[model samples]
Target: MFYTYILASQRNGTLYTGSTDDLAKRVFEHKEKARAGFTAKYGVDKLVWFEAFEERENAFRRERRIKEWRRAWKLRLIEETNTDWRDLYDDLNNLLSY
Candidate 1:
């Protein structure tokens, strides 16, 4: 599966959107600050929202579209699924472990 995901520094804080085939590993990299980039610099490491696609192209396309969305739109998207802005990384890892 491919994934489009959003990470935030905290509730109503900095946000980032990305797509990857390995969602868990990619989010882990961000959380650990594995690379010095926007996410690392801005401390956006919490997985607030994500969507999976059966095709890589679809995931990438979704990510690009989300990247163009206004901040309010993105925030609304997150809040729709995650009203408390909880970190979803742990749940993702747990699911993958099974």
Candidate 2:
């Protein structure tokens, strides 16, 4: 499965949109600052929202669309799903079977 995800620094702070095949792993990498890029530079590691796609093309398309959206729109989207703007990494980590 592929995924389109959004990472945010804070409730109305910086936003990043990207597509990846491994949602959990990608998000983990971002949090760990494993990759050097915009995410690491801006400290945008909180997984605000994400959508899974059956195809990579669809995931990419969705990611591009989200990237083009205004900051207000993106924040609204995140707020709709994650009202508290909490770090979703723990939730994803719990999904693992140890």
TM values, all candidates: 0.94, 0.90
Model 2: per-residue Cα lDDT over 1-98, one tens digit each:
88898998887888899999988999999999999999999999999888877899999999999889988888888889899998777787564333
Q: What is the lDDT of residue 92 in candidate 2?
A: 74
Model 1: CA > 4 A from native: 94-98
Quote the positional error of residue 93 for candidate 1 in Å. Answer: 3.3
CA deviation > 4 Å runs, candidate 2: 93-98
**Highest lDDT scorer:** 1
Q: Model 1 — which ten-residue stretch has the worst lDDT? A: 89-98
The prediction achieving the highest TM-score against the true structure is: 1
The models' CA-based lDDT, in order, is 0.95, 0.88
